[model samples]
Target: MSEDAEKIIERLAQDLRAGQFTPGSWLKQVDLQKRYGVGRAPVRKALEALAGRRLIRHEKNRGYSVHPADTEEADQVLDIRVAIETGFAEAICRNAVEADIVELGGLAAEFEKIAINGPFHLLYDANLAFHGALLGCARNPAMVALVADLRMRTSPAPASQWLDRSRIERSAQEHYDMVEAVRTSDAAGLARLIRDHILQRAD
Candidate 1:
């Protein structure tokens, strides 16, 4: 794909992730073209790429549309996420440096600020940044990429999971605790924290 097509994919993916497009809503090529101010070719390629990612569904006679929320499938994918993300705990602890810890702390702080009053999409973006930085401490690019894709596969509107204010607040605190775990080289503690965060089993 061309660079423009790739950029379009990311932009459309962001919109999907942010819940701007309702689940099961058709993504028309002309509408996408108008929204992104791009050509039909790029929109078509972007929609195809998103469909391949399972972020959207493709029909034989129809074009692409957002996948409807599936609780069972989302739960199954969340299990996979818990396994892979928690598995990264030891590597993340071993490889994380003081600078990385500080960066994570900053990201956590940013998330907390956003969680208090920011829009859902911004809060989601902050959450992603925190987790992305935390995972990057593992220094495993493949794991990071795979986990990211799995996250998108969990639900068509992942940001909808943050709709509860109390849950969002707890998540903000969890981010800080995760940073502390990395700072202290607490792999076991980090693993447990990650598992709880992913499963939302933390109190």
Candidate 2:
């Protein structure tokens, strides 16, 4: 993506995170043109990109609408992720090197800092990096690709409703535990930690 396109995507993602757009509401190109102060091309590109990720739906003549945040579907996605990632942790246990652990530790520290800070966009990026590093440790190209795609498709809901110091702290603790589990080559422990972490809110 060009720099301009990247900026548009980031802006749109931030708007989504800030609840500037509601689920199932149509996003007219002309409206976006006025809101974003951009021409049709960039707005069109952003909408198409989001639609491709299933974050938005594009109809033949209806333009684009924000995809509904279906909690049930989110739960199912979490379930599949837990199963695959748990198995991935086992693989990491068998193959991870010292460097991998060190990198993971650094990512965890970053997450902690974000937890202490108020801006969630940084936290979101760090969280993605931390997990992407774990998936990398699995050393399976296909799995890495699949997980990356899933990560984009499963972008977490806006943290606006869920953002609190206590929640951030708890999330940081989860990251710490995950890093320790990976460092100790505790595959089963890592698997359980991930599963519980993902499902915590579902409870």
Top candidate when judged by lDDT against the true structure: 1
TM for candidate 1 is 0.88
* lDDT against true structure, model 1: 0.84
Alpha-carbon lDDT of model 2: 0.73
Clashing pairs in 1: none
* Candidate 2, pairs of clashing residues: none
- TM-score, per-candidate, Cα-based: 0.88, 0.74
User: What is the C-alpha lDDT profile of model 2 across 34-101, one tens digit per residue?
Assistant: 78888889999988987786656799887998656655665676677777878788998777899998
lDDT of each: 0.84, 0.73
Off by over 4 Å in 1: 1-3, 117-121, 155-159, 201-203
C-alpha lDDT (0 to 100) for residue 85 of candidate 2: 79
